[model samples]
Target: MTMYWRAISEDQPGPKWAGLFAEYWPAYLKWWLKEGDEVRASYRESQRMLKRHMPEMLPLYDQLCELAGGGDQAARFLSFYCPPPYLSGCSQALWPGKAPVLVRNYDYNPAAFDSLILRTGWMGRKVMGTSDGLWGLVDGMNDAGLAISLTFGGRRVVGEGFGVPLILRYVLQTCTTTEEAGQVLSRVPTHMSYNVTVVDRNRKYLTAMMAPDRATLITHAAVATNHQENVEWISHARFTATVERERYLLHRMSLHRDTEEKFISNFLKPPLYSTAFSYGFGTLYTAIYRPRKKQMEIRWPGTTWPLSLDSFEEGARQVNLPGAA
Candidate 1:
C-alpha cells in the first residue's frame, strides 16, 4: 500500500486551497463513494448537522465543493458525517513525562491505506495528522500543544449522530485544552461508538467514551482500547480483541507508572502493536504527540518519521507489517 502527504498553510488564499482540493478531489471520490441510498441519506443528514451545529466550518466545506465542481453534493460528502465502518485496534495512553503526551497505535483495514493522507496544515498554529480520504482526521495535534486521538468504542450500534472523524476535526480546529475538547466531545452526537483521548499543553488529559444513545462518559483512566468499561461489544469480538488489549495497556501503564519510555517501547511489540492483519486490524503506525515542542512522530518497526510545527514534510513510504502475507 502507498501513503500520500499534502500540506497547505492557512495563510494561503482561498483559491490556493481550492486548487489543492481540486488536485485530490477525484482520487478521493473514487475511493470513498459507495453505491446505495443509505450512503446518500447519511450525507444529507450530515449536511443538516453542518447547517445547524457547525456553521462556522461551512465556508471551508463550500470551498471544497466548488473546487470539486460538485456544488452542494461535494460539501455533503466531504463533511463525512456518514456512518463509519466498524474499525478496531487502538491503544491510547496518557504518557507521564516532564511534559505529558498522548500516544496511540491506530490499527484498521490495510485497504484504507489506498485513501490514507498525512496532512500538515498551518492555521495560525500548525495541525498535522492522518486523514481518511478527503474527510476529517482520525488523529492529529495542534501547535497550541494539544493532541487528540480516537479508538473504536467496540460497539456495533449506529444512530443519528455525526461521524467521529468530523468531530475530531472540529475539536482540533477550535479547542486548545483538554477540558474544552472534552466539552465538545460530550455535546457532539456521534453516529457510532468511540473512545476519544485528549491531551493538552498543561499535561491535562481525558478519555471520553461516546455513543449515540448514551451521554458521553468521561474517565480519568488514561488508557482506552476498543471498549468502554463494562460495556463490550460481544458480537464484534472476532474483529476486536477489546478485553485483552485494554488489559494489556492497563498492566503496562501500571508497571511503567512514572515514565513515558517503558510503555512506548512496549507498545511497539505484540498485543499493543497488533499483528492481526488477517482480521483487518493491523497496527498501521504508532503516533506520538509532543505538544511542548509542537512536534509529532510516527513509528513503525525499525523506522520513524519525526515532524515538527516549524518544519513539515510531505512524503510517503510503504510499511511492512506482521501478517501482511
Candidate 2:
C-alpha cells in the first residue's frame, strides 16, 4: 500500500487547517461515533474539561472547532475528552551522545493513521509534529527546545480523561522544558495507558508512565517501549516484542557508542523496524528530533523528510510500506 503523506505549515489556524478538517472530519466522525455518540462525552463536559485542564489551548480549540464547522460532535471530538480507546506500538529513546537527540519509530496501522505533518504558530509559539485528531500531535517539538513522543502502555484499562495525543499537543503548546512537560504529563488524565518520553536541549530526559486509573510515574529512564515498569499485558508485550525492543534500545544506549547517524540507523531494521501492518503495529515512520537546533526529520527505509521551526515547506510523498495494503 502506498500512503500519501503531506507536510503543511500554518502560522495560525485558517484556510489550510479548515481544508484539512473538512477532508478528515467525515472519517473522524465515523470513528468518534463508532461506539455511538451517547458513549462519548457530551459537548458540555468536553468543553468544560478543556477549559479546566488546558485553559491555554481553549482559544486554539475554539478556532479548530469552528473550522470543523461548529457541530456538536465535531466539537466534542476535537476536545479529545473521554473519547474512544485507541492503541499503537512505538519505541523512543534519548541518545546519550554529545548533542541532545530524541528518536523514535511510530508503529501504527497506516489505514487509521493520519499521514500528516503539521507546523503551527498558534498562541505565538511555534510547534510541529505528526498530527492526530486534526489538532493533536503524536510526537512533536517546540522552539523552546523540548521534544516528546509516545508509546502504548500495554494495558487494557480505560478511564475518563483526555486522549494522549492531545496531552502531547498541550505539552508542546505550553511547556518549555522537561520539568514543565513532566508536570503536565503527571496531571493530565488519559483514558488509556501510555508511556510518554520527553527530552530537552540540555540532554535531560524523562519518561512518564501515564494511565487513567493510577498516578503517573515519572522516571529517569532514557528508553521507552510499549510496556511500563512491568509487563502488565503479557500477550501484548509478547506480540509487540516490547521487552525485546526495550532491551535492544538499552543495549544500544550502552554499546552503540558511535555517531548519532549510526544510532538512528538501528531503528530502520528489526526488531525495532516493524512490518506488522497486518497486526496494526507496522513502523510507519521514524522521527528524529534535535531540540537544541529546533529541527526534526521523518525517516523511512530509504527516504528522509526534514523540517524545522525556523523554516518549513509544504510538500507530499507517496510512501509504500509492506503489509499496509
User: Candidate 2's error at 316, in angstroms?
Assistant: 0.9
lDDT of 1 by residue, 1-325 (tens): 4334334344332565566567666755555455543465455666678877667667766655666676655666677665445466688887755687788998887665533444445334457777754447788887777888999888877887777887887788778999999898888888888999998888898999999889999987788888887756676654566777778777766665756666677779877777777765588888888888878878878877777766775555656676666
Clash count for each candidate, listed in order shown: 0, 0
My TM-score estimates for the predictions, one after another, are: 0.88, 0.98
lDDT leader: 2
- Local error of candidate 2 at residue 29 (angstroms): 0.8
Q: For model 2, what is the error of residue 190's alpha carbon versus the real structure, in angstroms, after optimal superposition?
A: 0.7
For 171-212, candidate 2 gives per-residue lDDT tens digits of: 999999999999999998999999999998898889999999
Candidate 1 matches the true fold with a TM-score of 0.88
Backbone-clash count (model 1): 0
What local lDDT does model 1 show for residue 284? 82
